[model samples]
Target: MAFQWQVDPEDLFVERYPQMVGTGLPAADVDEVRAAITDMWPDRSGGWVHEWSRLAGRYAAAGSPWRAALAYGWAKFPALADTPKRTALSRQVDQYLLAAPDFDVAFDRIIVDAPYGGGHVAVPVHVLTPPGWSAADPVLLASGGVDSWKMDLHGWFTELALRTGMRVLAFDIPGTGETSMPLSADRGFDVVRALIDHARTLGGGRVAHLGISMGGYFSARSGLAGEVDAAIVLGGPVERSFDPDRTWAYGMRGIVGNALGFDTEPTDTELAQRMSAFTLRQWLDQDRNAPMLVLNGADDVHIPQADTLVFKGRPETEVLLIPGTGHCAVSKFPEALRIMIDWLVASARW
Candidate 1:
């Protein structure tokens, strides 16, 4: 099955400051600001630049205000509004994911070690198989949750490996797992890369990578880093790059991460600010990693399913559109695991 990168672009969404965005539209105020910016800089990208000129003359009209608000979302959080570190934002976020009972996790352990010297750290990795592991299988990980575990692990990872041979190695990111590595731009891909290397030493076989939901970030990251033999991305987000101003939402997290600097990794509000400038799209597997499978959910609120499903180059890649699932709805469709097993078999990457 070849990956198809075609779905409605509208389904793609990167939730930014739900509290702020949830606030009534900042359109009215933003229009005034955009007009001022356009009049002064004249040279800019986007349709708003041209529209501003027309709106400038009709500033008195009711519709003019709407036009000016074109860049309100971007302006409200201009990448440097910097979330205050009033308290430990990292700890708060940690409690939300790791400690949150609603997450419903069943994993091997809280911390893990590498085969060689790569610096030890705690990674929340879920192994599909049990007790003693085998070398004939593969390890995989995805960005989203529930579905990845229920859909991929239970469905494909175990059966395929037990029958033909393969295993799944799924993990949450640093900030996501025990290692509270803030999702900084400079350090996003490094997490998957590390996992790939460690998996090779531990499992030692043709690695099959799985990128479900938000895991699309890790999928492309590990792929480009040239570690996995094959990749599977479900609802991959292929935007130009990180939203540059994504840090404004991390209110007071700097004080949280830095205060416990010794207890946690060194991450300041400035780093998060810098991260806003980059997006996950900046990194793509291209041909460096081949034999990829993309499963898309039509209503995935996080990563839209339409962007990276085409067969540009690869060992091979394919996309399957599941209509009922949201970002984490793979479990709803029983065919998901079967689709993946068939893909690996057809690609001969298993």
Candidate 2:
């Protein structure tokens, strides 16, 4: 499938920090790197890719293969043609492995079974345990949205685990990254349950879920199903996103459709139908709900602000609706991360 630009590629690149800032690059370098990517679809003038590729080559030549791999991964961001995407991804892996010995924490990449289509699918996860962490340590599943793949969240996930002292298993939501399974709203939680099952095997202890953007939806679902001990849903949409009356602006619909694995952008009606399958309001009956924390930006354009309020009456649920913040609340990442870490620490004791 030829990749379609969700929005003006320039605007998307300029607005990259809310998503890519913590991808193990210096702040100025992140800005410079994003500014250098001036590509658009229909002809994807690959100036951006070229720059990243050039950086990768330079890093490799300097004997810093991990830095090179990280650069190549940046080049593959969002999406690309299969041939180039695969090549970039392979280079990223090669570089990451080459550079692993230099890192403070070692990472284990593993695949777990998850339900997909009628059988099961493999869900790839990058696991990092704290020093002296035993199998008995609680596991926290960290994930990102449709556009934010797992690799991009590695640094953030690592810090989260280190701070909270929880074992971290970071992965992408179904529609993105290595999950690659067909996306179905109703079946998405099956994957979370499956991951929880796998987490129990690691230590047979508590497992919490923290997800950003689209991944938050899965975290919310897992919380509601009591599949996890705790969940932090950041900028997740529940009813408002799927409401047929509320039209999404800024290519939000297209972003969601891509996550749903649409061959083409689905019509408004079809999008609503598919999204409605993910409604957490229908499952809020005080049944198997675990402690939940719903956080979001008040000015979020992609997700309806009211969606965060859906957890209001639920027991052990907390909502932190920040005013003047944007989606994912990336600008306030430190504050948000602190809140989540505090909550995770508290939840683990319960």
Candidate 3:
């Protein structure tokens, strides 16, 4: 479908996939995502941007006008209905992505940041190392933010963390959780390298990066820097669906924060145009053919499956089509875990 698909011009870009209608991130990840998003310390963390989301919301209301009705499909602003200045973010994708993998069973907590002065932000990671866990465990950075809000945030991490009893590490990065690094590519890659260094201390080797939705871009950058053993992108986006101005929520946030380094906010539509600046083509240029698993819902409207359809790797590459779900919905589906876990463990590629 072209950027402008329907004739109605009603403003709803795509209908929410039925299977994903009530789905969400894992419970544990949800708490973490909420904490990171809610724990905004203005200026206390110099590099971090505060209230970027609110600015985005206000801009959306002023510019898109139709997004409010679209976002209303998700949550209710029961208490703040009359608050004039508040950002309409309950529907923002980031709000739901970070929670997951109930460590209903407690595990060890360790710090993943460095002690030296060069490190700008200190990030702590939760390490769940089950007994008899191998040293060569696949560690997912576990991004709990907007892009992944609709990805397989919970189902992938929960089953692997709980049932397979594999050694899994979940860390939140700046602009994400705890650590607040600048959005510059160089700085973000540094954090991934540092995370690997931190994991090394805990005896995690042959680390694999699992990138989901928006998380795929960062993971690709990490792979470019040789920080990971292999990478898997579930429901990964290889290309960006053009944002025709105020077409996306985070585009508005980037505008408010002047994230592109401009002094003033970019127009809503301008923000949308820039949203696709990062693409999988740039990330996969090295073509390491690092083991990747790409799964998509046949009905996914937000991110068309074609974006992730191509790859150089032969046997190591795998794709699955869950009949009824979109994005993260497959992970939540009871049988979906069975299919995914069996593949991961069976492949034992990592």
Maximum-TM-score candidate: 2
CA lDDT, every model vs. true structure:
0.43, 0.75, 0.45
What does candidate 1's lDDT look like per residue over 1-350, in tens digits? 00111212111112322212222225554345343442211224322333333332243244333222222222212111122211122222322233223222223433445222244455656555433446654555444421122221222344544443455565654433234444433454566666777677556656767765446656755555556787777555545323433331212233223312223333445444544543544455345556667776666554444445542444555656777765434434346667766776664553
Quick one: ranking by lDDT, best first? 2, 3, 1
Candidate 1 deviant stretches above 4 angstroms: 1-110, 113-120, 130-133, 141-165, 240-282, 285-287, 310-315, 328-331
**C-alpha-based local distance difference test score of model 1:** 0.43
TM-score of each: 0.51, 0.89, 0.59
lDDT tens digits by residue: candidate 3, 1-350: 00111121111112323222334313442233233333222312220122323323453556532232223212211111112212333343232222223333235556665432364567666666555666665544555333222122333465566666566666543333234343334555567677766666555556666555455555645554456756555555555443343233312253223333333445556555555454546655664555656665655555566655654354466666667766644434566556556655754665
Query: What is the C-alpha lDDT profile of model 2 across 1-350, one tens digit per residue?
Result: 32354566566654565555556655666666666666633324346566677778888999988668777876766553345665677787778778766655667889898877689888888888777677777888889887676676667787887887788888878777677765567777778678888887776588889989988988888888888888889998766776777777655566667667777767778877777777777666555588899998777878888889878877888898887778888767778888888888884434
TM-score of 3: 0.59
* Residue 126 in candidate 2, Cα distance off native in Å: 1.0
On a 0 to 1 TM-score scale, where does candidate 1 land against the true structure?
A: 0.51
Could you tell me how far off, in angstroms, the CA of residue 139 lies in candidate 2 after the best superposition? Answer: 1.0
